[model samples]
Target chain A: MLSIKNLHASVEGTPILKGINLEVKAGEVHAIMGPNGSGKSTLASVLAGREEYEVTEGEVSFKSKDLLDLSPEDRAREGVFLAFQYPVEIPGVSSTNFLRTAVNQVREYRGLEPLDAVKFLSLMKEKMKLVEIDQKLLSRSLNEGFSGGEKKRNEIFQMAMLEPTLSILDETDSGLDIDALRIVSNGVNQLKSDNNATIVVTHYQRLLDYIVPDFVHVLYNGKIVKSGTKELAMELEEKGYDWIKEEADKATV
Target chain B: MTTITKDNITDSLLATVHPNGNSEAAQVIRENGFPTTKHEEYKFTNITKRIESKIQSFQQAKPLGLTQQDVSKAMIKDLDADVVVFNNGQFSAELSSLGEGYAVTNVTNSEAPFSIKDLYDDSYLALNKASFEKGVFIQVPKNKVLDKPVLLLNLVKANDGQLITPKLWIDCAENTEAVFIEQTVSQDEQAYLLNGSVEIKTASNSHIHYYRVQNQNNEALEVNNLLTDIHRDSTFTSFVLSLEGDMIRNNVTLNLLDSGCEGNMYGLYLLGGKTHVDNHTNVDHTKPHSESNELYKGVLADTSRGVFNGKIFVREDAQKTNAFQQNNNILLSDEATINTKPQLEIWADDVKCSHGCTTGQLDEEALFYLQARGIDKKQGKALLLYAFAGDVLEHLKIEAFKEYCIDLVQKKLGTNF
Candidate 1:
């Protein structure tokens, strides 16, 4: 469903992702873990088509289409979603209104009819239960005074509404409590199907316990140094990234 | 008619003055002449230059034969209010429709209940006082709340260099409640000048809401002076929405006369092209326990310019006063400019007064967030701008008017949702 060949990217003339090669098939989950400043979030941002990140070398393909050729909004319309690390606070736009626009635009891009207000409200009510989000919170300004848990849950709610083909969760578990993590994981687990994919980008293996991944890759110094199965996550959780760094440094020497 | 030059504009205006004009006002204008850019209050706004170029052929031109269809086209659809139409600065009795609980008369045929002493300082006020021939006097009796609002629709249809002065005096007695919407619309494509003034008196324990809408043509130069005297235990709220104009200057002053009075001033200006709109508001807290709040927002596109000068004064005897003022602007184009100054002068130590101003472009991160949610760049920008203006629009109490203003703002921004 997604492929990256020797992808190299930078931000403001500073190289961050260098020669990152990854592949994910349909019906599978890929976890990319790393320590602080190891380019874990940078990879997610580049995949989401953030304007500040300049793709310097190599190419990325999603569903056999050139992903880098599309804008951020077009990327979302083409079934690519990025749950932001920090959702912005828009003071005057309500969450319901924001989601309605997003859903309608995505539908239009897919050559589908837009949902009316009554139908949209019913779909929202069903998704609210899945994420355990409050209707009152959705009626207020988008993430204006929302708690960290509520914000994360709202992101999941939006994901459920849009139903993207490839979902990239970047540091979603960083600010969540135990209960929120459980609910967010449950939402992602339920939305999984045979023809969709998800990339879980995190700093720790704590989220891997809820939504287990088929593969785990350790990123260090803008390059993926090691790749293994789910047991590698437990191995790194027991020990840390220091051993991986030592091994990567020895290989470079 | 004499050719109205920059040096002789004042003389030309005063030549055919009304018989009941104030002599002192004429003397003030004759002595000071029109204000130049060197004047402190008119530093940023070159009103005299605009008027001089537009008033060269100033004359008492005949009315442009405006009809009921023209008046109805400018009216708010489904608005059930008392409508009073003023065409070319003259009251159109045949076009006006009055309801119960209020009396409307010609100011020239009756004595004004209140004096315009405190508002006689400016040159525009003096110009309005010296040359205004047709004015309306609207009175609401004590303890009576009107069944509906009063809509003063001023329609100007002058294609020549005509000068029109429209005046209004609203007298709301004690224990009454009233809402007045003063809307100005132009019906021509050529140059003209509209020097207008409205004086409002809200007595003790009364409440009044005044809304001013300026959606004139591109060739119209408007100078509106609104003076409001709010008495004991009363509340006065005013909203000014400026959507279109060539050169518009609004001078709004509110005097809190007695104790326990509250005043609010809210404004929004969405301008494009070479349009210029200036809003200058002053709130005077004279008695104890008075409060005033003000917020004005502007969105300037193309080479449009906006100016906001808000002043709050707390006198020595006005202890326990709470005053707050804020002015914010978004310059969409690089050439668009805004000069905002919020001043608070508190002579009383026990008062709480604060003022702030900010001018910048819209937040890039917020715009990106909306775009990431699948909305296009233009729609995302429109949504963000509308959100930025929501704070001022939410203060309107009338639902229909609020929706009407929202529609106007969306149309101005080219927003679909």
Candidate 2:
């Protein structure tokens, strides 16, 4: 479970998230639909504890604990996972090596035993098959020359391996083809459980078709103006953001 | 002593060389000065800075404990081949192993009827020739194949108030092959200086791999001159790794004397806490159809200073000679300074030669990627920096030397394991 109360964040003194307040309970997929420059990414990054953002006023609690006090690495260990929009490419470090180290670090932080190589490889095999990822890609350096879809699939694969309590996918389906989108979305759906939550952030409603959400919220000018059932995403897709803009104007007037 | 001022030490030292032997190499240094900052060949390294300031008489190393048991121990290690181990610059013959293909003899006089050729007037060689108490001669016969890599352990005892000057020579006959590892290590953390010279000659179609690990004690100074000559179709590779010392200088030269020869020079130096290490490498493409490559990397921290100078020269007759050189360094502290220069001079119009050098800190993007994976900042930096210098470590060729490099890097990382 996660709660954001009037999240006011900015980057380089320029306000991006004016006021955002959302609450997501367990076993629910919430879609935050936004046009460009709507603070969707700023929310994901601020939650992930990116140092560039300045939180002027707001409070975000994850699992009933303050998230602002943790560093990015600490936040990562605390079951707050952000599937990066653009995954970083680290050369000379193999994918398996990178993931193994990350998994063990998180496990160690939570006072759990680390997985051995035999168990880790089996887990990776099962997850890669679920995400339709090639095993050869995992043997090479981490995303050094990976294709667009392969990178997205790799992100989902990592999500399955880490098994975080709350996962935020910030535009994971942007560059993916229909097949990759289906596989990635299917992997996310499979990993869903009654004790965890998910937030799907995107600009289009195409990905929502595969991974249905409990609630759809339209974000414009840094604030969520409209919240409804899944039908709200279909309405925004057909009528465009102009209708949301009009409703937002009436609310302000 | 009047001729030994720091300002004109080059001319003073070379001017006093008593070169009465048949070697024209020794005669040349007696006329011209020692390598100075004014010399274009030695411009980047500034070897004169250290040599000129220390004006003691060039005498043989005189340590307190040069017992016969140390010589016998040295002999046990090199039982199969011709090897000369030096402890504090004294040859431990009692511990040496001599082979049938080679004859270990002391240079009683400079004018011996030997097949060895001293072609260049390198002042360092002449200085070694003039001052060293003993020298080692290792020879491999024609068409011979050495199955084992020779280990020449040059040990500097701790707290031994001794200065060392080591002179070594190796000759490979035509179509022969060998690998030589010359390791320089100290037992104690004492202040001593070593002036050393090594000369290698490879016959046509032979190949040699030479590795030198300069992990002297922190309170020691090491100055080395390594010269190698490759004949037609011969190949030569050298790896230099420097770990600890106050002042260390590694001077390497490769002469591609014949057509279709190949040469490679690689080194990695990790220094901290006021350590100063300098690597100067030169590749001379003298004949056509030769090839050469060189790369040196360094990581310095805590007021340490690193200097890397790589030079490649292709002669007019050396058409089709392909040469490449690169030097990269990372300065971890703001006060840590790195001086790097990659110079190339090509006289042949049809040569493929290129050179590059750079100095900076760890790659920020790479650092961030590692940190994002939950790796702590200290370990992340260490891993990326180690990977940056991996190329040099991999090229060590010898298994022990490679493992030593890994251990050294891991130790440098300290308790952050």
**Which predicted model would earn the best TM-score?**
1
Please state what fraction of the native interface contacts candidate 1 reproduces: 0.66
* Model 2 ranges off by over 4 Å: A243-253, B1-60, B64-84, B96-126, B158-162, B410-417
Model 2 over residues B1-417: C-alpha lDDT tens digits? Answer: 343566566565444333553355456665765766687655644555665554344334454365556544533232344455776665667655544555555553263324333333556656656656566767788998876667776766633234576777788889988878776656667565577877889989998988887765776667788888889999999988787887887888898999989999999888888788888778899999999988888888888888887878899999999998888888788998888877788899998988888888877656655555566667677767776787677776656556766777767753232
By summed lDDT, the worst window of 10 consecutive residues in model 2 chain A runs over: A71-80
Q: Please, what are the lDDT tens digits per residue for candidate 1 over residues B17-135?
A: 66677777778778877778897888889988898887666654445588888888988876778888887887777888887878988766124456555543888888787777668
Docking class of 2: acceptable
lDDT of 1 by residue, A37-146 (tens): 99999999899888899999999999999999998899899998888889899999999998999899999999999999999999999988998999999999999999
lDDT of 2 at B369: 50
**Which predicted model would earn the best lDDT?**
1
Query: What TM value does chain B of candidate 1 have?
Result: 0.96
Local error of candidate 2 at A52, Å? Answer: 2.9
Q: Which ten residues in a row have the lowest lDDT in candidate 2 chain B?
A: B111-120
Q: Which CAPRI quality tier does the interface of model 1 achieve?
A: medium
